[model samples]
Target: MKKSGLISVVAFIVSVIVTASSLFTASGDPFPGPVMIAICIILPIIGLLAALISNKGALKFIGFTGNLLILLLSVVVPAVSTLFWNQP
Candidate 1:
């Protein structure tokens, strides 16, 4: 469980970085950005899976919440930025 929880934390952090970078690159083109966003989705799911495999209560809760936030940020941040992109 400890090992799995550690993996989850690492994946979650990487996911966040990927999501932020995706947003940072949103202005020019959407090619690599989209790919990174896909990664953003993938990493958290990986984390969640690791956590589930651990089968510990606290890690499970943390994993679920972190996974949800990572997924939410990946999608919501891009959408919100796009919506306000032209506002200046």
Candidate 2:
């Protein structure tokens, strides 16, 4: 694979891992939640953009998949959790 493709793949992998870890690591503290949310959103965007700009088909697929997973982890999962698990 080319350098750009490799970068895209790396970005996709790293973003997914970081986003997922942040989501799972969330605590009751107000500060960490927002910070994790920001990390979850930003990293996926970077991965998605990197994927969109790539010239390789496989890399694009990997990137988009990672972005979608991140979206679910960062947005949908939290919303569901809040709907069902909010402790207040």
Candidate 3:
């Protein structure tokens, strides 16, 4: 579970960076952002859940907090920035 949780955390961070950074590219498209954001949310969530189930002490709380940050950063911020505020 620890190994799997670590893997999920890495995947989640990478996906979040890739997905969020895509917004700044010249070829940016809205088509893939939501899907990738969904992936980012899922990966960290899985890690958090696994950590909780495995009784890994600090890992569980840290995983949850980190996952929440990832979710906000990779999903909510981009979404609000694009959909609500008209900023480029």
Candidate 4:
């Protein structure tokens, strides 16, 4: 396989693993419930698509976007959720 193909495959695998780990690591969860399961399943596919579309030359750009999205969803989403759910 070409370098780009290898990179894309690696990116897809890494993204899927990270997503799975995060979903499975939540304190109260043995398995991710339906919604989390869906997100975990979908996000890596999206990341793979992004990586494929951008080509290996733009892998960094695709990675940055993926990381940013993960950070936003994992950090910002929970903080905002806490504010609303735990409001005075």
Per-model lDDT = 0.75, 0.68, 0.64, 0.56
Worst 10 residues of 3 by lDDT: 51-60
Off by over 4 Å in 2: 1-4, 20-35, 80-88
Worst 10 residues of 1 by lDDT: 28-37
Pick the winner on lDDT between candidates 1 and 3. 1
Better of 1 and 4 by TM-score: 1
Q: Tell me the tens digit of each residue's lDDT in model 4 across 1-88.
A: 2354445545555655666576677575444577554454455555556555554455645554564566466557878889889655
Q: Estimate each model's TM-score.
A: 0.61, 0.61, 0.53, 0.42
Cα deviation of 61 in candidate 1 (Å)? Answer: 4.3
The residue-by-residue lDDT of candidate 1 on 1-88, one tens digit each, is: 6788878878877777666665678574334755765678777888888888876677677776788798787667778899889966
Answer with 3 or 4, whichever has the higher TM-score. 3
Q: lDDT of candidate 2 vs native?
A: 0.68
Candidate of highest lDDT = 1
Return whichever of 1 and 3 wins on TM-score.
1
Report per-prediction Cα RMSD to one decimal: 4.5, 4.0, 4.1, 8.6
TM-score of 1: 0.61
Q: Per-residue lDDT of 1-88 in model 2, one digit per residue for the tens?
A: 3555566667667666665565466563234666656657776777677777778687788877878777787678878898898577
Q: Is candidate 2 or candidate 3 better by TM-score?
A: 2
Q: Note the residue pairs that clash in candidate 2.
A: none
